[model samples]
Target: MKNVLIVDDERSFLSSVSEGLSAYAAEFNTLTAENGKKAIEILNSTQVDLVVTDLKMPEMDGFELLAYMSRQFPDIPVIVMTAYGTPEIKERVQSMRVSQYLEKPLDFKELVDKIFLELAASSEGYIRGITLPTFLQLVEMERKTCTLKITSKGRIGYLYFNEGQLIGAETETDKGEKAAYEIVCWEDAEIEIESICRRKHRNISTTLGHIIMEGFRLKDEKERAVEKENIIEVGIEETGEVDGEEEIILETLEKEEKMNTLKDILNEFTKLQSVTAVCLVGRDGFLLDSIARTGIDTEMVGAIASSGFGAAESMGRQLGKGELTMSMLEFENGPVMFSPVGENAFLVIVAEKDANLGMIRLKLKKHSHELAAVAAI
Candidate 1:
């Protein structure tokens, strides 16, 4: 069980919060305070693993508490729950490196997850540590604009950062987050913090773009394919016999051949002035194979893109809009390609500035139909 501290001015709110957390009764040992002064007194002596504090307290507010923690117990995770937030206060909290932030009328699910993440955070060596809600909320608060890209499984995606929040996203051939979501239908790794985006393009219609990528052209996440150290076994019989079924043999052979051929394509693309690498994923953004020059971690790329695909779909549904279709990504070194294979899959490609966009489009225009037909089979 972990020890926790709750500091708030409102009696009812404090009790309600305590009760909610106590529901997990056995997992956490909770302590409460009516004001920041009492909370500080408790912390000065007792050992508390986490703190759930309200922003505005009568005496000694959340900021004061944050300062206290920073000075004495920086390692202890602190989560700020507030109804109102100002730019100045938000900036101050960011600098403090608060573990997480919660906006009032607390989201129980989000809150629980935040706690879990804080608990799971490694105390020792860590390269990339992500405080989800805080980071995401900061982006929204600041309204910063940028692009965040990620890849996993065998797929890839592009997330558009607007005002420091996830405002939009897409794939190599799609226009918006919605289209990217549908094509890369991965079960996990779908959140924005771990998604994809390159150029942050806004002129294209995301839905149509995803459809075009999957239904019209067969593409893949070539530039970001994870280099597998060991050879993967594609297919085998029940008894580990490869001679049982002709169709199985053909299918296994096809997957391997495609991956190898795709590698060749990526190698050549990297050599071109405006070309990077190319990927051949399914209409659903399921990576079939890929090619790339730079050592891009394709597994992470595929997982992230798949989640982006899902988010795009969820956002579209919330808006009472249609499904996403295709998208694209532009990067400093090269551009990422997205082309659909069929109803359930799509493809992605990475290229440099000099890669012929017109030629790529023409090629996709011709191949997408065939790819979609195959996907249906």
Candidate 2:
């Protein structure tokens, strides 16, 4: 659940706001403060997720509190409020990391929406604003599972969390796991988790073995294209040519004809028994496309490979030398080979952990030039 701390200098304002929040049904643990001093003490002692404070106060102004929060606990979302929304105050509040600023005679709906957005974001292990859903999806793709337990009114509930979203409940309720799943998915359930225990017992979307078989099947299909002749060829293929765009087009046809057999040529490398997936991605890492056994996001895998290879390039540049020749990444159950085909492309092959690296490296070396030319297309 998102925790909200509201601070105002006016005693009546504090009481009314707190009482109003109480009167209205909501899913938040709301706290109130009449002064900044009490707010600070509470902030230091408690895990206050979001803060709403008045611009002008006795001890510390909203801006002062903003500055303090920014310096110390920058992750906490702050929203500055004031009756007089002068240009100066607006600009000042905006300058800080305040999530939202509100004028007097607050629009409760807007405030509620902003609060909901802020709290939703904060619940995803984010203090301040950061890209979400994408990160959350990435975690889901990884198939992570845990227990999210929250406490309220002295009663704590344990909800089962899968990947990054709450999937169900560890503790049986009146309705059971089905209700927990529905509640977490549809309702804005604040998993005010008092504790978390990561127990990876749940099944993932795809298994490693399944991914490998699909990769091998892709390689087999590529092999059938072998008997074709090079009716054309493309480029300044890999190396740049002095000729301009017109010639590049002519070269493209040539490349197409040559590569009519390119996939087949890649196939000649002998698809390993351990191959889970064989994907062809551009040098920049955009997946030209892929072949996977299971429901894996081939696009994401392509992106990850591209990103890793990009980082590798950066590492090479930092040394002022040493071009990235070949690279390999090993997981517990499998490994990925980053075989550079040319100046701007690579051949990625996923193999089982137990697969022979020597054979894979040899095949990559043999097909390095051919893969580069194909990728350039």
Candidate 3:
């Protein structure tokens, strides 16, 4: 039996859905959460097949949860139920890769139908699966405005199309044109589409056809490099008569080197007294790395930052302005600044209320190129 997770602040609605699903859709079991935070906790502990969520809630809303899932559980399809069916909300949800969007006063049976349809389609054979490049081409040909959730290998990617023109793309730790290239190159990808495109500005200026062609070129180059490296490794292993443990040690050492590089960069940000927290968040809204003082929720901060940045960027586009370079949100007690570190990731800086914005921006600008290099690797 499949396990379905439902989230809403209304206890009565939650109870009704849980009981109704059991009675009407006997093939599935249900779990419930009062808000996004609780839903995330349940998701961490339980193995869930599908998520049905409401848009607005206290603490964490549907948008934040959707962003989180796009990174951590891209393979799972989500159905969004919202009382507010505004165009802006629809566009935002689409950009976040929601599987289905339904307005409030939802017909329970219709919701169940969407759930079962998504589950069934995902279970189909390899031949019937949606090919990532082909789907994008079709979207372009049809002039469809929608968001696509793509699962390739172990990563989840999101593609937003405005009237069939590719505008934005995102992955767990990447975004924009680079994310688009990486996503289309992966094999055996599964796709989920929801109509609506919220992104206003175009982060990927390249044509879709060109981007797809480039993706293929990159994939071919990567494969050739890997093959050459593997041949060299095999020859060395034969000559040295190395055991499995030695190979494991070499792999561990390589990983440690990468981690050290990331740590060194994070340490530099933490050294600032005005900075209370520094987090690197992927375009898909996942936390890549973070350093924080005590009493901070780094994961939540990353999620909120990703959403805020995307929304602001979209608004800029809609206004015929250029891409978003940096944004600052000031609260009563503190201020938060967000900036694009690279095409794939962003930096979120939390500082005291009286922190020096000018100095922080200057420092961030100075190290932006170095940070981008680190992020790319």
Among these predicted structures, which one has the highest lDDT? 3
TM-score, model 1 to reference: 0.36
Give candidates' CA RMSD values in order: 18.1, 21.3, 22.5
Give one digit per residue, the lDDT tens place, for model 3 in 1-377. Answer: 77889999999999887888887466778889999899999999998887888756888766556656655665666776765446643443332222455668878888887778667745652122223564465466446687888886788988889987899998998989999999877776666666678677788988776677678666755764675567557655655746756566566545554566466557766655357998888887899888999999999999988899999899999999998899999999888999998898899999886454554664576567656766776
Cα deviation of 122, candidate 3, in Å: 3.6
TM-scores for candidates 1 onward, in order: 0.36, 0.33, 0.36
Clashing residue pairs for model 3? 175-344
Q: Candidates' lDDT values, in order?
A: 0.55, 0.57, 0.73
Off by over 4 Å in 3: 84-98, 125-377
Displacement of residue 215 (Cα, Å) in model 1 is 46
Q: What would the per-residue lDDT of candidate 2 be over residues 213-322, giving only the tens digit for each residue?
A: 33333444454343222221223344455456546565666565555556555454334435666667887778754555586676778889999988887898898867
Provide the global lDDT of candidate 3 against the true structure.
Answer: 0.73
